[model samples]
Target: MRCPYCGSLDTQVKDSRPTEDSSAIRRRRVCPDCGGRFTTFERVQLRELTVVKRSGRRTPFDRDKLARSIEVALRKRPVEPERVERLINGVVRQLESQGEGEITSEEIGSLVMEALKALDDVAYVRFASVYRNFTEAREFSALLDEISGDGREAAVDEAGGERD
Candidate 1:
């Protein structure tokens, strides 16, 4: 490390400590020539992620955008904000675990749908309607059917009886 005051290459690390998040290391350095001290941080750099849009355009991965979409879909629902945040983190983790530089928006949407489905049906439908771009009423009916069918199966299994 170089001394900022005297521009001398005579700096030594005085202290080293891990950051609060444990994602990085914080180092304190002192310039022997000028007796000046400064701090530096070191962190593991991950490869940048690109998000491929539905239109085939590519952009940098954005966590806020993903979170905002989830928030909107879960609005007026029983879902918690922390749940949405965790879902976003889960989607991001899934993409990162692939170790790929670019991922399709469809993959991201699918992860979001899966996460939401495990949370609330209404929220899942809201997200699926926007993510899948549902146009016809039949599409919504199909979604309703899927949701209700799952409920029916669960109820029947619990009852251990045949449907009327």
Candidate 2:
């Protein structure tokens, strides 16, 4: 590891352990040349991801951005914070496990929509409105109808009974 203080390439790791969430490893390091100590956190990344935009522009995948979008959709909602974390983690894991270096923005949007759909109806509709670019009242009505139908079907299936 490179020392942040002296810009030295030689740094000795003194301690390493998994973080509380086990999402990353915390490492303590010291630079021999400058006698500087610093901490670093690292995570196991299967591969770096590039997001391919519909406009033919490519950008690096950002987990924070994804979280922010989800937060925006879930804003002022009654969902628990822990469930939100799990939802974000689940989406990220699905992306990483795809084993592809490049993913489309549409694919990411779809994944978030699915996660939100299972978590909260309001949040799901909130996200879908923006994701699907609803430009008219009819569009909103169509989406609401689709959502209601899906909910009824899910309820019937979960009850182990035929749909009435």
Candidate 3:
């Protein structure tokens, strides 16, 4: 690993262990040049996956990007970071095991929504608002109703009623 302090390539691993969820290996490393210590978590990638954008653009899958998006949703919520990591790990595993190299953006969004809903309601709505492009407060109401088992169909009809 390159030293973040001095940009040196010589770094020694002092310790290694599996994370709590066993999804990644936690490594403590020290840079010989700058004597800087840092911890890195490494994960095994089953395969290189591609994300198919809605506009027909194909891009390499990014795990950090996925985590950032989820973190934004879980921001200020009571959800634990470990749970978030597990959620992200689960989504990545599911995508890799799908037997296909390319996955639609919609599929990823759906998986995130389902996972967030199970983890926390506020986080789910926060993610849904952006993933689903909620434009008004009523859209949120409809989603909240659906989540709360309060007649989603009726709520949607009322919220989505004539906006003119």
Q: Please list the Cα RMSD from the true structure of every candidate, rounded to 1 decimal place.
A: 10.2, 7.5, 3.1
lDDT of 1 at 139: 63
Worst 10 residues of 1 by lDDT: 154-163
lDDT of 1 by residue, 60-80 (tens): 988779888888888898766
Provide the overall lDDT of each model, using Cα atoms, as 2-decimal numbers: 0.76, 0.85, 0.89
Order the candidates by lDDT, highest first — what do you get? 3, 2, 1
Best by lDDT: 3
lDDT for model 1, please: 0.76
Find the 10 residues in a row with the least total lDDT in model 3: 155-164
lDDT of 3 by residue, 1-164 (tens): 89999999999999999999998999999999989999999999999999999889999999999999999999999988889999999999999999899999989998999999999999998988888777789888778878888544644332244232
- Name the best candidate (by TM-score): 3
Candidate 1 ranges with C-alpha deviation above 4 Å: 1-45, 150-164
lDDT score of residue 11 within candidate 2? 98
User: What is the full ranking by TM-score, best candidate first?
Assistant: 3, 2, 1
